[model samples]
Target chain A: MMCGDEYRESLRRLKPEVYYLGEKIESVADHPAFIPHVNSVALTYDLARAPEFEELLTTKSHLTGEKINFFTHVHHSCHDLVRKVKSLRALGQQTGSCFARCVGHDALNAIYSVTYDLGKKNGTEYHQRLVNLLKEVQAKDLFLSGAMTDPKGDRSLSPSQQKDPDQHVHIVARKQDGIVVRGAKAHITGAVNAHGHLVMPTTSLKEADQDFAVCCYVPIDTPGVIHIFGRQTNDDRKCSGCLIDQGNPEYGIVGGEALIVFEDVFVPWEHVFMCGEYDFAFDLVERFATAHRQNYGGCKTGLADVLTGATYALAEVQGTVGASHVRDKLVEMVHLAETLYCCSIACSCQGYALPAGNFMADPLLANVTKLNVTRHVYELARLAQDIAGGMLATMPSESDWKNTSVGKYVDKYLKGVADVPAETRMRLLRLIEGMTCGTALVESMHGAGSPQAQKIMLMRRANWEHKKRLAQKLSGTGESRHD
Target chain B: MPGQKRRVSLKYCGSCNPLIDLSRIGQVLPAAISQETDLLFVSAEETNIDTIIILCGCPRACGNKETIRARALRCIVVAGESVDAVPVAEKDISTAIIKKLKPK
Candidate 1:
């Protein structure tokens, strides 16, 4: 496993074209806006080295049989899928926010299976190339940002029909040595902090859109690669000295997504895992979605647990802890939170091995889990705000609370109950506001896939005709039905 | 009256709540509001209050226009909605009713 210092050094070496607040980030690892997210990624590396978490966080690489970070390991069994969820939940609980590595973790598993199947069908050596890449990733324990979701210009247009051909990431040229790609991947989590990026096709392609169906790996600092970090709600809090104002001060919201622009970047032939394999693109996207959707149950539920705990504490401090109504509201929150957890676990338990021998989560259930998440996570956050009360939004800034003139007055007036300090209530409310009303909730809604995406998958996978036939048989409403 | 036991049931189903204490009152108040109330006070925002007044006066027998108007005015105040000017007595009466029925 990579050491924390080594990870920091590696990031320092990368001359990534990263911008934050409209200015270029000279040193992302040390920047205040990016440091917390970097530290969260560092934990992924640090945890693998721990003796207690070795089993769950580290796994024997399928290629070398050497123990590697679980993020770099291929799923060899159903146990691996379960372990992945468990490990992510543990990380989520520790961070109290997105750790930003699950995308790469799920992406690797997906490409592993899809590439193998593609090679089997097309007689391509992409699978072997991927295995070689996996060995290198294992040896280095590299942190990779899975870059998907191209800058789709129009919702109704396909990659070929787009007014701007570059709106979707596509291979610009095929050189003798390798291929060159151009375009941008938007909302890429951990792009600025990662050592490398695993670029995948965003959606399925047709024969006409062959160039758009491309996948490869490239270092973040590769020449011509530029990163423009997307702003999060209350992102300015990173510069603020108050820890409470920045909820989960040690880990920022949802991996600090960035728009990664590839301006004719070259990919070595070995690194180019999928080039113009249009038929396999959909499978790859679906598999990636499955692994990622399974992750929501684990990580988001862990976040919901933190929100629930914080809300409960807020209630206690407000002298409403003993109220039956308060107790019931909390109970309802717990129920919804645990319901999400159950979906995650259920999907994991129902996982099966892909043809390439990597375990994949059940597609229908995983999609359902994510679908339920898009709704309930928001509801949970709303309920948290309700229990936390308007004070969460109206609390005084930590700096003002510390001012000499106003400090005493704030302390005197803002005290929730006699026992709890005014600062404590302010801190709790700030944290609640940060999580509920900010980027955290939006990330929960849009990340993985939106509710509409999951509903589409659920409709496609649902056995509606079978249900209709069964209903006809039981109700004797059909012409051919026998009682 | 001391010996008699009464049970009442109130059902609330909708998207928004103008009564801030409706949830609390539902839990703390007895069932008499649902069952034993010969006079039903329909509290709603002004946007819907006028409609409630019309329906209650026309279709329902137990509905009292004064009580409905008072409740409606109270809800309007709570929801920050516009309503016709309230008489001094009506304002005091509604405020008193709210304080008694939905105490903070």
Candidate 2:
């Protein structure tokens, strides 16, 4: 795997046509606004080489017999599945935010797991195509962003019924060499920095929606592709001359999201993984969603750990760390965060092997993990905010703290506990504010699909009929009515 | 001593979240150690050294320890509040490294 510096150089080499605030961004890796997010992405590479994290971050490739970053690895067994969550948590805590690599990792496993079944059913070579791609990715130690989540125009309609045909990415034309696709993928995490994309259908499709069921892999900087960076709150602060105002300056608060439009991008035959596999679209979506849901346990809880640390740090600076209420809040924050961690581990441990020999996390438990992540992450953030006090909201900007005229006043009055500098307090509070505010909460709510999506999946997988039978048997009325 | 030579490879992780500056090891110990023992930079792809010294920026020890082969492995983790080394030092790192390299 590339080190952090090499990863940066690799990103700089990309010729992606990216835009930020209506202006063209020539080099995403060099842009100030994108640097923090790039740094977040870069950590995934560096940590893989890091001695302490190597066990969890690097694994032996099954196809190539070479060492590869865990992000590019297929789950070989249940232990690999458990290690996935552990590594995500470690990276999450280190970055104190979404590292952005997990999305691609999750999507890779989903595609790798489902293609074998698809091949068995249809006599397709999709599984071998994916295996070849996996070998290449492992050899290069590259990042492949999982591109799903289309910009569906109407909530009630399917892909085929949409007024704007391009709302969901589709195979628009069939070429002699391969096929051409045109459409967009929205809220894609780490797309700007990825080496390529593993594009999949975002929704279940009918026979009429066969064109939209196309799944393929494409390089990020290919001709006819355009990326528009999505704005995050306080992003400008990261690009600001003053650094502390943007908390977690070393890493970003959430995955840097972008909207990528594929303008009739051409794909050769070797890279066209799945073409018009409409019936398997649901399987792909379910596998991807469940794997992604399990990740909430791994990454979100890591973020919760950082928030807990920030809360405790603030309490220390304010000299209220010893207060029973402050201590209680810290315990509560840990409780919620750990509960999410438990969900992640439980799902992974319950994972089973698919036909492709790739392990898939338990669908029911994975959904449960994500559902808990939805509620507990906010509650943990709330407890952290409570422990941090009101200053997180009312604190003056870093500029005021360093300004010439009023600087002295801020230094004098804003000081908490004798030893902690006013600037230190402000720095901690800024970080606390950056994460707990609207951005993180929104991501936790909507990133891996919304809470409602999880509930729906859970409903489908609940096995209510079996449960009813068990209830009857326990109540000594089993089969009485049937007879 | 009859021309006994020892090669040591050094590696450093990017100081993303260093508790203390990790460059001090290179600054203070490299020159002295190079005089008594061979100091080298091993590519992640190569493993020719007799000893590996991982200079980590913090307790996280964020370096590729796996497959980075050597006869002996030692780490110096520069933590936020403390300096944790494999063999505790009582003086300048150069003198300590020299002592370690040239055993009596």
Candidate 3:
């Protein structure tokens, strides 16, 4: 597996067309705006090489029996599923932010199983093609951004009914050697830094929408591919060269998302995993969503651990740690965070094997895990803000703190305890603000899917009729339909 | 048996949330083991390693799996406050490990 420095150098070798703040970026690896996110990913590589982390971060490849990064391994058992969660939490604790690799990891697993099923049922060669591609991906330890969400022009209309055909990625041409696709994938995590993209359909489809059921690997620097980095709250702090204001600066707020436009991008026949297979689109979407959702409890809980620790420290610094209510709020935060962890562990423990011999987390429990995250993370943030007090919002800029004139007054007035420096208090508050504030908080609600998306999955997965039968059996009121 | 010391190697699970102090155990184990038994600690990469010591923070013993154990003739697992599935106190863990390495 590649080491952290090797991963950084690998990004330097790629020449992706990435634009940020209306300026075309010359090199993403060197840019301050992108460095922190890059560092977040780099740690994943570095940690795997450490002897202590090797057991969790690196695993032997089932395909080749060689040691490889866990991010690139396929799940073969429930053990693998549970380990995935544990590994994610470990990385989350290390980075204290989105590590930006799990999306691609989920994509790989979903595609692996889905393609195998498709090949067995349809007598196609897509599965072998994917295996060959995966061999290289594992060998090189390449970073791939899983690109799924499309820029749906109208939510009410399906892909074929959209006024603009390009709203969802579709096959624009079919040739003897390959196919050409066109559309844009929005809010793709780790887009600018990744070596390539594993693009998949966003939603299920019908016969008329067959053209949109396309999944292919596109290199980031491919001629027609263009990336525009998304803006985040307090993003300017990165470019401004201020240290303390940008809380958790080493790993920025959320995954460095980007809008990737595919202007008739061509893919070799060998690289295409699915095309005109509308029937399996739902399977791919559901599986990918399930795998991705299973991660929130692990990663977010790790972030919560950091956020909770910050709140406790701030409370102590302000001389309020002993208060009963303050202590209660801290306990409440732990309860909520651990509740999320329990959900993730439950789903992973309940996981079963798929038709292709790979395992997946229990769908209902995984969705429940993500659904709880949407509410609990916000509550965690609110409690953190409540404990932190108003200085989180009104604190002077780091520059103002550094100034020789008013700096003393700023320091003298903001002091909390007698022994602790005001600077310590300010730094702790900034860390909490970064974790609980704008972009980071919003990611919990919508990153994998919105709350409604999980609700939809729950509705489908729930055994309502069977549940009704159980209720009838208990009440002795109605005859059992069929036990 | 009187003059020669058995060579041993140590590996660790990347302590993300270790329940025990792995670093402290790692620091004192070499001298402790040498004093108690005719065992000399060596690098994990040594080809002639007689026994591999896998130090994990939890019972998960992630480093004690087949792939890791396949490195040497025999393996010893130190998970949290336990050695080889037997409970040991934090203060006596080093002595317990030393006991295991001593000849019968």
Candidate 4:
């Protein structure tokens, strides 16, 4: 398996067309804006080779029986599923940020089972095609960014009904050898640094919207593929030459997201997993959502571990560790984080095998895991900020701390407890600021689908009739008027 | 004369949020097993293990994968308060495991 350095070197070889801050990026591997994210993804590779993390991060490929990164392996059983959660948590603890590989990992597993079912019922060869793709992915140890969300010009209208047909990626031409697709996928995680993308339909499709029901793979440097990097909260801090102010500078907040515009990108038939199979769009979407949702509690808890430690350390530095309220807040943060983790573990353990023999996490519980993340993560950040006090927001920039004349006054005034360098408290506060502030907090809410998206899944999965029947029997109202 | 002691191997799942006390169970199992049967606990890496007990903190029992189960002749899974999918109080986990290891 490739180490972290090898992963970065691999990126250096590919010249993806990525633009950031209104300027065309020469190289994602060398750019400051993308390095932290690159570092995050690189850790996924490094961890796989580490003796300590080898078991958690590496697994045997189900198809080839060759040792492969866990991110690329299909879940053969509940063990694989549980290990997926654990690996994600392990990465989170190290990076305290999104590693940006799970998106494609989830996409691969979702398509693996969905295509198998589609092939069986429709007499298509999509399953074999996907297996070929999976084999190549494992062999190369490539990073794939899952591209599902479309630009979606109008929120009220479906893809076919939209004013602009290009808003959603749709098959424009179907040829004997390949097909041509047009439109854009927005907020694609790891798009700038990935080797390629596994593009799937963003939402369910009707017969009228069949053109929009497309799924395929596109190399990052493929002709007509363009990536525009999205901005993050305090993203400019990276370019500001201030280490302490950037907060987790080696691995910035959230997965590095970008908008990918597919300008009539052509795809070979071998790379196309689904096209015009509008009925399976919901299946693909749901399966992808389930796999992706199963991650939050695992990774976020790992992140929470970091945030909690930083908070506790800050408290000790500030001489507030002895405070009863401070300790209680810390306990509350752990409670929220662990509760989310329990949901992830429960869903993973309760996973069942899909028709193709690969396992999928329990949809209902997985959705619950993500929904809790939307709230609990926020509460954790809030408690962290509360205990951190107003200084978390008002801390001086790292530059001020370095100023020759003003540095002494700033450091002397900010010193909390005795013997500890004021820089320690400042560094901890900046870390909290980066984690709890704008971009990171929003990622918790909307990443891997929004709160409402999960609520919808929960509603559909909940057995209303069964629940109602129990209530009716308990209340001695089983003999209904209709019955 | 008593037959040779059964070499038992111990394994654990990644303890993310264990509902039961896994460390305490690990501490008490050796003493309990020696009394009921000729069963000796050993590391998972050891060969000739007659049985393997996987301690998962919750019902997930993540360590009960086929990979781990294949390491020994017999596998006993303890998930929180359940032994081999049977309910047992947390305090009685070691005893229940010992009963499973006993020869007929």
List the TM values for chain B, per candidate: 0.24, 0.60, 0.90, 0.91
Grade the docking of candidate 1: incorrect
Which of the two candidates, 1 or 4, achieves a greater lDDT against the reference? 4
Task: Give me the runs in candidate 1 sitting further than 4 Å from their true place.
Answer: A478-483, B1-104
What lDDT does candidate 1 reach at residue A332?
89
Q: iRMSD (Å) of candidate 3?
A: 2.0
lDDT tens readout by residue for model 4, A446-483: 99999999999999999999998888888888856458
Kindly report which residue pairs in candidate 2 clash with one another: A49-B63, A49-B64, A50-B63, A51-B63
Model 1 C-alpha lDDT per residue in residues A122-156, reported as the tens digit of each score:
98888888888888888988888999899899979
Error of 1 at A33 (Å): 0.4
lDDT of each: 0.76, 0.82, 0.90, 0.91
Per-residue lDDT of A194-303 in model 2, one digit per residue for the tens?
A: 88888999989999999998888999999988889999988888777778888888887798889999999998878877789899999999999988998898888778
Better of 2 and 3 by TM-score: 3
Counting only residues 3 or more apart in sequence or on different chains, how many pairs clash (N, Cα, C under 3 Å) in candidate 1?
0
- Using DockQ as the measure, the top candidate is 3
Q: Tell how far residue A350 is off in model 1, in angstroms.
A: 1.2
lDDT of 3 by residue, A1-483 (tens): 998889999999999999999999988999999999999999999988876677778888889999899999999988888888888888887788998999999999999999999999898788888888888889999889999999999999999999999999999999999999999999999999998999999999999999999999999999999999999989999999998999888988878999999999999999999999999999999999999999999999888888898999999999999999999999999999999988998999999999888899999999999999999999999999999999999999889988999999889988998999998999899999889888898899999999999999999999998998788888885764543
Which stretches in model 3 have alpha-carbon errors above 4 Å?
A479-483, B14-16, B21-39, B45-51, B59-77, B81-104
How well does each candidate reproduce the native contacts, as fnat?
A: 0.00, 0.00, 0.61, 0.03
Per-model TM values vs. the true structure = 0.80, 0.85, 0.94, 0.85
- Residue A449 in candidate 3 has what lDDT? 91
